[model samples]
Target chain A: MLIRKPNPIRSSEITSKDNYLNRREFIRAGAASGAIAGASLSAPAALAAVIPDEPLAKLADIRKPSPFSTDETLTSYDDVTTYNNFYEFGTGKDDPHRNARDFEPQPWSIKVDGHAENTGTFHLEDFVKPHTLEERIYRMRCVEAWSMVIPWVGIPLADVLKALKPTSKAKFVAFETLYDPKRMPGQRRRVLDWPYREGLTIAEAMHPLTILAVGLYGEVLPNQNGAPLRLVVPWKYGFKGIKSIVRIRFMSRMPQTSWNLSAPHEYGFYANVNPEVDHPRWSQARERRIGSGLFAAKQPTLMFNGYAEEVASLYDGLDLRRNY
Target chain B: MNINTRIRYVLKPLVFVLALLPAAFVVTDLFEITGRLGANPVEEILDRFGNWGLRFMMLALAVTPLRRVTGLAWIARFRRMIGLFAFFYIAMHFAVWLVLDQGLYLPGIGEDIAKRPFITIGMLALVLLTAMALTSTAGMRRRLGKRWNQLHTSAYAVGILGVWHYWWQVKADILEPLIYAVILSALLGHRLWHRRARSQGVTPRLRANQGAG
Candidate 1:
């Protein structure tokens, strides 16, 4: 039951393979020469002019425009795929795009562990077979004071968690990204503790809004965008949406996350997008919308990235300032 | 052409254009005239300017040491132009942060300068560079006399602060900043050795063309 919606515009129609591939080769050659001016200027510029509009691998039977989808302007496919902070690929903003070109996302499988009844490794297709994929246009706000509106295609995490039949002892859900240094070159350097990890309280994990995204913009997830599978929690900061997940565990207690482990003072576990709690290095009150023109003014960061109405009650009594 | 004429007419202008190339690239990227910027163009523009500013400042500092070591007194002639370019790039960095990134938000700017250590150090470096740039003229140099040397000595301080600012601002991967630190250390370290040798009245071979300034 592999569900896939036919794409109206084929990728080849938008930009021929030879056209973009030659450009990529030229940029790669420019980059290897250590010419910073040529690499930085020409690479992104060439990408802008001829960004491929075709979806890589169309997901089957995606329900269009979910009730949870936002009506906001979508960040272009170019920006969404080209600009990423996937440190597993590299730390530079464009490093993921440049470095992750060779990563293979197929033949993927997930290991389910902890107190869950289905405590074994399952094929990716099997895991996704039971759920109906839905489109959720989420507002992704990064802790670095930038944002993107992404239309993700995935199934609800709640339905998946319910099917797994977590035991009463399961109070938290822990996730781990694939940790193959051969595949993920950035892991070779100790960027933020390898095999990037993230977790959520059982309640938050089971929230209706929480989704495990497999694709974006109705296409197969690009490797840089965490291909195969990634988490999408609209209410939280973008870092919380861990990418390229390989493990899901039912934890009895709070599980350690990568960023919180890296710099506890800067990134809290519950990385809800609260404008008031400023990052020590920069203000969190405003965020520049990615793909917005150079002169576009930064928009005021919203509470819970504008999902406070849906999720504020999750932390009714807790002080976010202290927790943050 | 004579070496002096070539340097003044051809080489100096070449260096000026070379220095301006980074800014030109940024301008084109900002307008998407050539290549487009990354997802966040402001961040890209800010970083390009800051990186170039740091580079020019490094070049400014290197002029004296290079001239001393290579016995090239002509190198000193380009120091002012390089230093001014450093100031220009850094000012543009500050301008982008103020206008495009911060959107002319006074409170945010004020808080960043006051609260963030990196921003604070960066601002201090800019202020020092500004003072040096203002007094860089020949007339001001004559008027300030010996005091001019004292004021320009803050260039070393600016170098240190510039590196420190970059070091602190990075999220992770301090490799780039660490390289700057090592380069700055070597430049300043050469100066320290030269001073020590001068005081001992035993000039090293590398100090052959010293006192060009």
Candidate 2:
């Protein structure tokens, strides 16, 4: 329910007394120079150019260099995903970033159950290490009206599932984020359900576009945004890319996800992030990117976050609007 | 002098300190952001202020009940300051959310409220708090008079909304908000029971005299 789109941009170079309008000597400068207007809008880019050399050098070796890269991505551990769009984490964009700091992710473990060949638990680190970190600049659309371009670091979910070897009967791969009432102070109320469950079809989980990320923007994941580990499905609503995962199960039947089960009509298991399938409440056509130029408007959303060419095959026969 | 005046004298400084706390927190938050505060300073600063608002509002609402139960009528003297504290921090909270987070965009902020029921309720609680804060003064109380009691009684409604507002806002692991909600419910229940007892002619003095040693 938290809406986090890109920040709005306005091109205003003149730091005159009246920031709102054009008048006087400062106005003379604005009148004298149209290029300064454009230059001022590029400030976010100039700021983006500066980066700490640490996280990039320490990039987890498990992730592969992203096959698709974009210069426009908001790449940083804290910026890309730490500020979540999860309503369950409080309706504020920064709530997850603020509230999740207390979580300790090092000693974590994820249980793999159901139709998976391995019914045992996997250490969080070990599980994370098998996959390589890639910088995937993907468009993340929230169920609430907003969007962001994130440079996520992690390997394909298929790479992890390939090692697990889903049993022949496995039809769906269900994921569960850590639901500790202790760390996630939000669990005091029964808003959706504990453990914040989500699921993808086995085929969808194995799709190359579905990633299990450890961190993003060359830094450790922030606690509020499901630090330690989370999923990144470019084609699905951001909720499907759950945070702070603790359990993963491959099931023969479609799994019961928290939101879909809570409100079948409002949220479906597919939860694909499709602009065509508008939520009953609001339009999903446009998105705000974080740190947009001073004068730029929010950009339009792409189908499958521009990963449609890669992920369209998975949803071929399904009606996204009906299933969404 | 009566006990009421004595209680008033004690509460004056206490109320003054509590009243100043919300502003102090805002100043503290600004100071912390200057990079002077300790680790996890931002969250600490935000919570310190936000929780102060919620607690102050609850205490302000408790004034009427406290006055009735203890017969210390002067306890009403502190209600305005406490209610205003609630408004002060809550407004600051909203400001922080809008400026720091959303960058003051109307459409994006509106979408968040509409999509998230939790946010909608939280904002609604703020609206109610603002109403209570504006009407908390003696001038409004006297102007409304009998209507004041009826209108001010909306505090109970706001109290419930506040608890739900906090509860709805959490993402996962909701134990803390639930605890807050339960505590508020029990406190409100006590007042309701006390009111019923009063209407039923049940006075503590009657019990005391009947059971005298």
The TM-score leader among the candidates is 1
CAPRI category for model 1 = medium
Each model's DockQ?
0.53, 0.03
Candidate 1 has an interface RMSD (Å) of 1.1
Return the clash pairs for model 1, or none.
Answer: A3-A60, A3-A61, A4-A59, A4-A60, A4-A61, A45-B35, A45-B36
Clashes of 2: 31
Q: Compose the digit string of candidate 2's lDDT tens values, residues B89-119.
A: 7777677666644556788788878876766
lDDT string for model 1 (B1-213, tens) is: 998999999999999999899988887876778897777888988999999999999999999888888877788889999999999999999999999988898988999999999999999999999999999999998898878888898999999999999999788789999999999999999888888888899866655332223
Each prediction's Cα lDDT score?
A: 0.85, 0.65
lDDT of 2 at B140: 85
Model 2 agreement with the true structure over A1-324: per-residue lDDT tens digits: 532222212123435522543243344344434543454585433222111222233453434456665556563444554556554465556666666555566677676767876555566655654345676777777675456677777777898888888889998998887766676776755666566778889888988778887666666655666667789887787888888788788888887788776667678888776766666544566555644532245566788766788788888898878878
For model 1, what fraction of the real interface contacts is kept? 0.79
Off by over 4 Å in 2: A1-65, A73-75, A78-133, A139-151, A159-170, A175-198, A214-230, A242-250, A258-267, A274-309, A316-322, B1-14, B30-52, B91-135, B169-172, B203-213
Model 1 misplaced stretches (Cα beyond 4 Å): A1-55, B31-33, B206-213
In Å, residue A41's CA in model 1 sits off its true spot by 55
Predicted complex 2: DockQ: 0.03
Count the clashes in each prediction.
7, 31
